[model samples]
Target chain A: MKIQVLFGTESGNAEIAAEDLAESIRNDNQEVEVHDLSSFSIAELQHDSLYVFLCSTYGEGELPNTALPFYADLSVVRPDLSGVRYAMFGLGDTFYKDTYGQGATKLDDKLTELGAQRTGEIGRYDASSWEPVGEGAVVWFAGVLEGVSATR
Target chain B: MDAPLSIAVIGSGPSGCYIAQSLRKALPQSEITIYDRLASPFGLVRYGVAADHQSTKSIQAQFSRLFERENVRFAGNIEVGRDISLAQLRSTHHIVVLAAGLSADRAMEVPGEGLPEVYRAGRLTRLFNAHPLEPTGVPTFGKSVAIIGGGNVSIDVLRLLIKQPEDFANSDIDDAMLAEYGQAPVSRVDLICRSTIANAPSDPVMLAELGRIRGVRFSCSDPIEVAEDAPRTALARAKAIGELLEVDPGPETRAEVVLHFGWAPVSINGDGHVRDVELRSVNDDRTNQRLGADSVVTAIGFDFDGGDWHGLGALKADSETGVLDQGLYRTGWIKRGSRGTIAENRSCAKTVADEIIADLDSLEQQSKPGYAGLPEEVRALAVDYAAWKRVDCAEKEAASEARTRRKFPSHEQMVAIAHNKLVESSAAQRGN
Candidate 1:
């Protein structure tokens, strides 16, 4: 299967996490493609493609600046993604209590509403803890790997 | 048009590196060259932060990777306002980012503020951290010291002064400065704030982390008086402080930190060196009190060193985008003022990078020679990444015997080392 990694970020944290995850999965001999959410094609939400969304919440738990277009289009177009399977990880600060990880949750909800099945639980990393997203993504990939195997 | 774009970043600090990192992602075909006035890179990481915070300095590991990129280069010892001109930068490179940071130290207009013993946080940090630009080897601050601010910089200064020399064994502190500070008569540091504790701008973690350092005792005066329109971040900080109050100081204390809230420095009273400061309460002016201290550090904050007097004055930084004007842009301190964590510069630089990426279509077509086109005088003086590595190796080598990481500690010596006149492993005589 061709794995797709999409990142949404204001500070490039999500993108770094995606790139690290994509490289690690590739080293395991799997084919992976990494993309910025702004450039990612929604039409690619088809069957037999594995997906991982690395996203960051900004501005009171809102979507990243570049991720807005994707969110708007995906929500409005509401593409049929019944065959799509994906996992998500969000970068947020706990100091932002009300909006913590809301961006990723919103996207996950929209994707699920569009008939996509999540491969595993969403991961949330806090800035106050000073956790580098790349470090968290590596551990989150294991659950994603299990989900992919079971579905296949 | 050539798909690859050439970029010039004026300052090799986190702000510059973050822009380079974002540009590599936003525009893959871009080539980034970082320039600094000093022979070293990683501006504040190398020279601004207190030396005791070694782990904080490790952020260089990530920045170092940016320099190794095939399309990236670090050019040091090149002054923009003097060695090169802003007009020259704009003519040669597609984008010019002024990440030089807030270079000027903001001093108060109060009387006697410029006394020999009084220092600003910016220059003091550079001096303690061993930046080549620091004027002298050791600044005299006899016995008691008073920092007139409640921010993290004040806290950092407090820790640097109160900590023992052995505490910096694994750090990159200047050996000479550390030894001087070690011998200084400094024993008590008073943090004078204009508002209550909650109103102070420093992170609560700063207050709680005192447990890690032995011999330092911290005592604050009342909770912060939360303002009606106090931002959410500050309110959150107050909540964090509520949590930090739970930590208890362990035994083996030596130095003491006394915090005076709701007090402002009215004037400095000193004949030659600092002797005393007259502090006035925030709510009332008549409530004047005098405190004795040999040294006073104005750890208030920093302002943009806008060289507007030069006609090419820098523009004000935008809240959302860092576009100063037309083709010229900015990031980091000069753009946003000296605030926010080091990591926050990533987002600030990313915003500036995105603006540049969007304007790429309208940018002037690729020019020949790029950085090589710099005037021969400036080009000859530029120190590339390889020379910086040698300087690094030399600094480490010099400190090897003391088992501490020492630095060139002076601009003249660093430039001399880059010119190959100073041996890497041997003690190079000080001065240019």
Candidate 2:
């Protein structure tokens, strides 16, 4: 089974993390495809069983510049996700309080609303942390592998 | 192994934060506090770097870690000389590192420069970047602009004026200002200089970066060219100054960036507002010319104002190893004069840090109470890191869907939101 990794980033932080995660997934001997959300099409949802969103929230809870097109198309057309299992890892700074990691939650909700299965919980990483950067994303990915393997 | 030492770093910008981070690494137990006049960190980075340069602004993420440390603290809305005197900080902390970067613009001293339309590049930069210190909103620069001095900053301002609103969609530039700039009838930019292109303070790389921007034709009064077989750096600069570099702008092009080299502005003349920039050639004949310009901007260097404010006088200290004067030190632009970029401050700061560590044993120790020593009234007025975060949330939350940030340009407005949150939090606490 092929796994797809998509990322939307403002300051290139989430994109770097997505690359790392993609490399890690490839090391697991499973075929994986990675793309930036700006270039990714909503129609590609039918091609894969496993879909992963690595996105960062920008300016309150708004989507990154690259991810807006994906969100806009998904919202207007309301793509059918009847058989897909998806997971999300969002990068955000809790300094913004109420608006932190709205990207992950919004994506998670939209996918579930369209009849897609949630393979794992929405993982949100606090940008304010110093020790072991983006450790939350790694911990969240651990939960995802179990679901992906069980489906395989 | 010893009692925690107190250290105060003035200016919560890149230099100040770097000092805190360096000191923390050297002395993990040291209590570090950063002070700023504004209710925000990343001083100039917030109010300096071009809006289009998101990658450069990303340096703040690295500085953000210093605030989260148990030993490090942010004390906002405090001026060292006014709120608490320089003497007070010296008595409170064992070490006080003054990293308050240059705040004043050097006067051009040219005739008619005193006109209202003629302004400093630093002032314009702050106004555009939404500096809290700059109470004034964006000033109007009319259809034609004449920029004096040739440097990266001159290129930066030119880039800003020529860019379309769509280019700023992903940037933290003021969305309202973007809308205002969209309607600006700006069609020409004249870069006035008193010397040859080689004498210009800006780098070849910066000129190359300016070249990459789309939709702008280039020309010069002189036949701009570099010698054959010039180095890569020289070749890039020659090409930047010589070529009419642009990307597929149809018809007559949107705007033109014309270089007026070897021409010194003799006067910035107008009736009550800017009308033209009068110039004299650097040649022996001293030819005179006047270009019709609605606005004139001086991009000449910055001025250091620390010593004049405090009783310190000139603010110069030996930056070789360290100043090594009564636990006082200086770094960044203030130390070496405002010349190098952000990365240059790191090495200079590290050298000072080494000196600080070397003298730690011999230096007299004091049981100082950093920000905690501030009177309740002063504390109330100061915006702490948490309160700033609330203001940050409010600013971001207020932005339009397509915009990156809705900045709190007015210092008064930011202070209101920051302090109001504190009042509500305290009121709720009393009820509880």
lDDT of 1 by residue, A84-121 (tens): 98888988766456677888998899999999988888
Model 1 residue runs over 4 Å out of place are A1-14, A27-152, B2-4, B223-252, B283-286, B304-310, B314-321, B366-368, B397-404, B412-432
Provide TM-scores for the models: 0.78, 0.70
Over B104-164, each residue of candidate 2 has an lDDT whose tens digit, in order, gives: 8777887888888787888877766767666665566888899998776777787788777
Backbone clashes in model 1, listed as residue pairs: B198-B224, B215-B253, B215-B254
lDDT of 2: 0.74
DockQ of each: 0.16, 0.02
How do the residues B1-432 of candidate 1 rate in per-residue lDDT, one tens digit apiece?
A: 674577888898989989888887777776678889888999988888777666557567567767765368888988887788788887778788888887776667789897998888887788878777778656677778999988888888877887777676667777777777777647788889786655667765565455456666666555545666777556655655554344454676577677787898889998877889999888655568898888998987777665481255555544556776666788887778878778779878877888887887887775645687788878877778888887888887887553446787667667767767654331333212
User: Candidate 2's residue-wise lDDT over A27-123, tens digit each?
Assistant: 7776888898989989988635678888887643768767889988989999888888778888876645556888878887888898898876777
- Which residue pairs show collisions in model 2? none
Assess each prediction's global lDDT (C-alpha) against the native. Answer: 0.77, 0.74
What stretches of model 2 exceed 4 Å from their correct place? A1-152, B181-183, B203-205, B209-215, B227-232, B242-248, B280-288, B316-324, B419-432
